[model samples]
Target chain A: MKILVPVRRVPNPDIKVRLKSDGSGVDTEGVNFLVNPFDEYAIEEAVQIVEKGGGEVVLVSIGTADCEETLRAGLALGALRGWLVETDEVLDSAAIADVLAAVFKEESPDLVITGKQSVDTDNNQAAQMLAAKLDLPQACFAFKVELGDGKATVEREIDGGLDVKEISLPAIITADLRLNQPRYAALPQIMKAKRKEVKKVSLGDLGVEAKSATKILGLAQPPARAAGQIVGSVEELVDKLVNDAKVL
Target chain B: MSTLVIAESRQGDLRAATYNTIAAAKAKGGDFDILLLGSGSAAGADSLKEFGAGTVYYSEADAVAEYTAESYAKTAAALVGEKGYTAVMMGATTTGKDMIPRLGGLLGAGMVSDVIGFDGANYLRPMFAGNAIATIEVNTPVAVMTVRETAFDAAAPSGGASAVAEAAAVGDDRAKFIEYRLTESSRPDLGAASIIVSAGRGVKDAEGVKQVEALADLLGAAVGASRAVVDEGLLPNDLQVGQTGKIVAPDLYIACGISGAIQHVAGMKDSKVIVAINKDEEAPIFEVADYGLVADFAKAVPEFMEKVKALK
Candidate 1:
């Protein structure tokens, strides 16, 4: 069995992202980029599954050469090897899915694991799109996943609570935030990962349509909230809520 | 062009998300059709007529009773694709987040998730956890979207009844639903509650969560928690209110010991009136709070509870 985990390089979640002056895109000038926080969880889960059972974890990402660093980070974390699907064009969730679907056909991995969504675009779409494109069953928002008997049992967090689902192998699974805490790359492992070269694959070679259908019209800051006034005491706060706001 | 809105219900009762998505459809300024899937779906369809749905497409099948992502996504995609609807919309709930993209991919359509505003052509959605907004445009034949319910006013439940028709059935059993375990609570749902009392990391322990719950019960409000507290295992994940959690916009939101991270604010910033109670006066939560009280919440929350009790 082989596990294929897709990773993405996104702006650091803790940093505030600024929009370009002309409103075309986000400003990455002074921002630091790293493996999308959620994808780290995916990588962690992939490694755990392969370590418990007998399999190899293959990491794949779609981006430019800049993504090799992210792949190496996964390598340090325990992925057997990596494939960087290098493409300079801005691909939407749909286009990215096409590229991954092509890779899925070539690799024929037993499972495809990826983050629920990229914190950057906040578009929780890619994994679902890949599932659709490849005609595979998808278990999303997975908090707990178990692999055995040629099937995967996933506990997914839904609207009200959790639901347990059983999907056969050759499935796509999206990792939720609570899945697992990613471990830090140890110093020796980081040194070893530097020597592990990632294979670079061109987007054009896959022959998948790599253009995004969506367009960004503009970007703006949401309306600023009105500045609040400090109340003298809890009594004043309750009074304000009862008399002024009438919320009580 | 006509629009289609997917109606989601749990255990035969329509959830608030159904109404919110209908409201989003109404924002597009035209008559729209609503699609309801599952057993006893007609009742859900009947309830949705008032939400400006001129027609309801009721889809029922045994497999639709238990929601498998594949089945729901395929059903919706097939319906929207067959109808060639110009716009397909739904609430940005967990189910919507899971299903919308599959529909978009099947139709080769561009999708905007967690949409806050839709002005016919352009969509306004939050980026960087609500620090900035991105207005996007989709040029595909059909536009698929999931609206952030909190960003739009919920559609009214009273209006002229719409016609209901049985829609075509489409699904596959690639996955099986073993069971669902829901957190049973008598209190109002956090997403639709008019008032919310939310606790954060500063609350410290499960006992702290109880104190906040006591305050919430007094006001007939829903209990909410910041992602930090939920992640810390002091509260359940469903109560979490943040970027990755449930987005809510209640009339009054009282933050108890919550230091406002942008992710936390993104979930509740649309609240009509926000009250922040924290010992740290410099917390970013104060910037958005309509009323700020700088005090240790241990002292302040009890004071609030006592005052409301005395007033009652």
Candidate 2:
């Protein structure tokens, strides 16, 4: 079994991101970048599956050379190899899905796992789009997955509940929160990761075009709430909620 | 441009988010239709007609009887192709988030997910959790999108009855639905509730959670939890409100013992009114709150319940 995991490099989610003054995009000037938090769960789940059964886990990423670091981090987590679709062009989820679909045709992995949504865009669209492009079944927002005979049983996190579905092998699964706790790379593994090979390819080399179907007009800070008063007691708070806010 | 709004339903009743999505479609300024797929869709189609849709289309074939994206997306895509809809829209519910991109792929269209508002021809959506809002435009002839339910008001009935039509259902053999297990709760749904009382890590334990629940029960509000509490296993995943969890904008949001993490604030900052009670006076949750109270939740929650009870 060969499991393909796609990782993305995103601004560290701990720090609040700021918009550019010119409103073109986010200001990446001094921000730290790391593997998106949700993608870490995908990497961990893939490695665990490969560890249980004898299989290979391959990591793939689409970005500039900076993404090689992200792929290497995944390799340290136990992936056997990495592939970087290197491009500096800003692509939307649709373009990313198209590129991944092209890679899927070449890799022919038995399973594909991805983060439910990138922390930066929060679009939550790529996995489903890739599944549709490949005509493959998909289980999105999965918190529990059990591999079976040529099939995978997945428990998806849905609104107000859990939905369990069974999908065939060679399918796509998007990782949600609570999937698993990702382990940190040990010193030895980190040292070995540097030796692992990451093959770089351009979109043209993959026979895919990086075309965006959506255009960003601008970005701005969200409207801020007015400063609140510090009520001294619970009674005062309740009164303010009922009288001043009229929300009670 | 002709638009199609997908109506979501369960147990033969239309969900509240469907109304909100309809409101979003209406805000887009066009004559729109509604599509109802799956079992128990006829009743929902009938209710949807009251929203002044041009037509309410439904399908109940065995293939599309259950809510699987494989079948539903095929059916919706076919309908979009047949009618030549310029746009397809739905509420940003779990089902919508799962299926819209598939529909977009099948149609080769551009998608804008979780839209909050519209500025002329461009759509406004939050990025980096709600810290920044981006204005985007779909460049495809057929656009696919999902609107955040909390950002729009529920559409009111326009009293113009719409025509009902039956549509053919398309099938897929790739995925099979086994079962759905809903969290059993007598309280209101967190997303749809007007009042939400959320607990945080400061609540301390399961006992603390119950105290917060007691306050929620008094006010007939839904109970929410911070990601920290949910990670600690104090609450179920469904009740978590944060960047990675449910985004909710209720009329009133009360955060108890939660330090306002940016992720947590992303989910509830759009709420009409926010009240925070934390022992830490400098908790970040207070920054976005309309009212802040510095007190131990253990003492404050019970007092809140008593005070709310005295109101009735």
Candidate 3:
């Protein structure tokens, strides 16, 4: 099985995020970036699948040169190779899928893996959109996966319960946090990844132009959370939930 | 046109998400109608009727049997297409983020995941985990968005609602149902709890967590751990309350023995109220906390529990 892992590199999880000058996007002027935590699980899972089942793990990403860091990180974690679908501007989910669909056509990965959602956009739509566009089976929020006998079984999270799903090979699955522990890159592997090939393909060069069917008019900020009223006792708190706030 | 708030329910009662979505839909300041899509969840519709759901289109059929992404997306697309809702709102839980876009694709509607608030086409959402916020509006006929549960208020039940059941256009079996396994962990629901008492590496290990959990139980809160604790395997990944683990907007979020990290704060900063219990008064969490208690957590836990029990 040849597994494909698409990832996003977002600002480090440690910094207080600032908006761009125009408030159009995040201010990444001096923020550290890393592989999206959930996508790390996807890459790790794909590598494990290939390690066990005998195939290649291909790391895929859609971003600018900055995202090369994320792709390289995936390579260090055990992916066989890395590919970059370079774009000038941020691509929306469907547009991203359009470019990925082209890659799918060429690579023909037996199993395509993605994080449940991108940590930055948190759109959580790429894998499903790709599956819909490619007309393939999609199992999402998967915490566990098994592939054997030409079929893949995925454990999915449902409302108040769980439902198991089985799909044929050549399916798409999105990884959730509960899937598995993503390993830290060994220093030796990181050194080796420096020698590995990370091929970058521009959207224009790939003959795929990013055209969004929907246009973003603008972004808004969430209401500032009010300063909490700290009460003297738990009894007062329960009273608020029961009488004042009436949540309980 | 009407608003479509996908009501989330469990064990015949509505989840906090349903109420949050309802409050948001009403923010449009118009006639509100809700769609309850699930397997044999008619009770959810009945309970939610008092929330001024002028109409309830409940789906009861094989299509709604389980949360198959294909079925929900197909059915939701058909519903929105046929009824022509002003907006199709969903709870931005794990399920909504996965299913909404598929529905958007099926109906050829515009998709926006994790919309905390909106002014016309512009919507508010978080970036860099939850440290910064962004607003974007889509110029599309149908705007399908996932409601950030932490951002909206739970709508109160009001008068009455007219409920109707419809056969789902999408069949549950349209796509194959995959295997699902549930992992049970010790910590309380980081996102849904009223009081979340979290510990970081300062707590030391599982035994140290027991000290924190003991205090949490006395206070009727859930146990949460920092990413550091989670990274050290002192707790499960689900118990990690941070940008990467679970972003909880509970009523009262507390930190015990934790030196606040940005990732940890990003997960709980939106909480309605906060208290920090740490030795270091200068911890970043204290900056956002409404109340600060500087003391040795080892001593603080027993003292706090004693006070709580005495109050009780």
DockQ, every prediction: 0.80, 0.86, 0.40
Residue B265 Cα positional deviation in candidate 3, in Å, after optimal superposition: 1.2
Instruction: List model 1 lDDT by residue over B150-237, tens digit each.
Output: 8777788667778888887777777888898888888899987999999998888888889999999999999999988987878777
Put down candidate 1 lDDT per residue, A126-245, tens digits, no spaces. 898888888889999998998878899999988777889999889999998789989999999999988886888898788777768788777887788878889989999999999988
- In candidate 1, stretches whose alpha carbon ends up further than 4 angstroms from where it belongs are none
RMSD after Cα superposition, model 2:
1.0
B100, model 2: CA deviation in Å?
0.3
Candidate closest to the true structure, highest lDDT: 2
Once fitted onto the true fold, the runs of candidate 3 whose alpha carbons sit more than 4 angstroms away are A157-163, A184-199, A205-209, A213-248, B11-13, B172-192, B231-239
Model 1: lDDT to the true structure: 0.87
Q: Which residues of candidate 2, in runs, are more than 4 Å off?
A: none
Candidate 3 per-residue C-alpha lDDT over B78-189 given as tens digits, one digit per residue, 9 for 90 to 100: 7777778867888876677767777766655567766677666567777556655665655567777888777777888777656656635576442576344544655456
For lDDT, candidate 2 versus 3, the one ahead is: 2
Categorize the docking of model 1: high
TM-score head-to-head 1 vs 3, winner: 1
Ranking by lDDT: 2, 1, 3
Question: Which prediction has the highest TM-score against the true structure?
Answer: 2
